[model samples]
Target: MRTRRLIIGVIIALIVIIGAGFAFGALHKTKTNAKTVTLGIMPGGKQEDAIWKVVKANAKKSYGIDLQFVNFTDGDQPNKALASHDIDLNAFQHYAYLKSWNQSNHGDLVAIGDTIITPIHLYSTQYKSVDALPDGATIAIPNDLTNESRALHVLKNAGLITLNSSQGLQATVKDVKSNPKHLVIKEVDASQGPRTLPSVAAAVINYNFAQSAKIPASDSIFVEPFNADSHQWVNIIVANKKDRNKQIYKDIVSAYNSENVKATIEKEYPDGGEKAAWDLKF
Candidate 1:
């Protein structure tokens, strides 16, 4: 009986020592020291980088989190890295994209917080507007499962196509109920949408790709509108399911949504290109 009580006392002491940082840092809602977290993101966006500049700096100052970043060139890599514990967090994909990824991989990743949504828009070089496109004209859109669905929904909202009502967020060309002009949609990699603009009548381009191609907002023919139902499009901070409730992740979210970070986002996309998702109600 004495040995068992001694073992129990030792376990309690160990718990206290392990939890000491959390107890002392409870006021800040983060560990009191410089705990490192590896974040994965796709490189090359000015706005995202600017926002993160603020997030990274402030995370260290306010929460003692040393935010390190790993830039992934491939669109499919960030989540894969997060799943394998190669990364602590990722801030590239939206909720719908994450959901599809989870379903396809049978993985258990969860969004810890909302980030920003850099919306996709239709851009054209030959045509001035969606109404000006010639009949049976070719349109280019993202070929991936999540973005293809999103691009189709954008076209449907622009009155160029009618999608099957039951298709929900993953609509495809086959789900188009009507295509009155017989327009041909060329499915290309998401990054190639802007490059296809000079050839196709119009291309549905993700905001990041358009920015990368230096296509200004004025060059777009149609912009996708946001609504209460557009929650799926909002970008998110993601982590392994086991880490979803970690206080450090919560601190990171708070850091990202701080006033300074939000102001940086507003300054970067002042023309309404990409807005912070903190205040957006789903």
Candidate 2:
């Protein structure tokens, strides 16, 4: 009985020491210094780079926190890097895209605050106006669910097509209840839509894809309207769920939504006087 009791006490002491060591190490690491935050963005384009410049400058001014900007060449790359901890946050996607990614990937990425929506645009190679297109005109739209529906919505709003009332934002060609123009709609990958423009009558392209392909926003035939209802679809700064409320997160959002940032976005992705890339709702 005495031997068993002594062994049990030793084991208990050993476990306590191990637990205390882990606690101390964690505390020490956390206290070492303010962490540098890395922000992931889409590869440098005139519009996005201009906006990030404002954000980086503001973050430095507001919190004395260093914002390191990393660039990804595609839509999915930022999220992938964030999941791997190669980046601490990202600011290139909107809530709709972010939500779809989270649902499909079964990941816990969350938007910390809203940015702006780079408006989906319909650009044409053969015509300057939506009504001038001839019958059987070939129009291109993003093949993915999120952007495909947004393109279809633009068509519906233009009175070129009618979608089933129940179809909502996920509507596809099959959901088109009316196609008065007999438009031949082709679904291409989002990034490829702009390149397809020279071949098709028009292509409904995402803003990032358009910018990357050097398609000017001022040259597009149509753009999505910026309104409060579109706020959820506007671009956002996102972070892992664990880091949503950290000081760095607030600083990032603050930097992106500042007046300086707003003016830059306007010059970058403007429609009328509004910055179509972000709603400025935050």
Candidate 3:
């Protein structure tokens, strides 16, 4: 009887240990397989759509991370979504735009990685070159402060007009100190730039919008210089300052700046539309 009782107690002890081991294994698996991360992106170009597909696959294969992309139509929504915690990350807007946004909204967004530099271009259907534009020609520029200043700089660089040096990146048409050709500057919504080309002699259009309108880079009368000096305009991957250093966010940045994605950007945007900012350090 004593032997039988000891055998029964040993069997019960073994069963409990086995059950506990299975429970721990299940819990560990649950912890490892969390929900996919959602990223916000501006909707427009095929390049962005293609890049997101590659990122999703690479993230899953390389780091066991699943990624989902949510497209925001306008410039304002992406930052707003990120700030409200509606999205995990956003890959749009340059450093200047981000700085302006932070200043206006009191937001704490920070760039974790550099993505690309989409050169803002002066496009025209009627004029072939900046010098070809006639006197009193109406030139359309983005109405937004950041892009208006950038357009003015491009005009100044192209020798079409001059801006007040002190006005800097905050420059508007009012800041234009001189117009050599007496060029009539029209401030329109950035999206309207390409559309206004038929009405105006020329328009300064952001690259993404130009690409969306199927405007060839060769058609640009003037293109912004892609160099260290223009680094402020390089688009970036952004997150809330508090979450900037998270390991998962770093993994996403790594996937974006991966060699494969870089290759894709090189092949797709070979023209002056958008160049990958691979050399930029975060």
Best by TM-score: 3
Better candidate number, 1 or 3, judged by TM-score: 3
> Per TM-score, what order, best first?
3, 1, 2
Indicate the TM-score of model 2.
Answer: 0.74
TM-score of 3: 0.84
Clashing pairs for predicted structure model 1, backbone only:
none
Error of 2 at 194 (Å): 4.6
TM-score of each: 0.79, 0.74, 0.84
lDDT string, candidate 1, 1-282, tens digits: 999999999999999987996676685654445499899998856667788999999989998889999999998899999999999999988889899889989989999999887778998888788899889999999999878988898898889999888977778888989998899989999988888888888999988788779997777889887764367999999999999999998999999988888888889888778888878755
> In model 2, which residue pairs have backbone atoms overlapping below 3 Å?
116-235, 116-277, 116-278, 117-277, 117-278, 118-277
Q: Highest lDDT, which number?
A: 1
* Whole-model lDDT values for every prediction: 0.87, 0.79, 0.85
lDDT of 3 by residue, 94-151 (tens): 8999999999999999999988887888998888898899999999999988888888
Give residue 233's error in model 1 in angstroms: 2.6
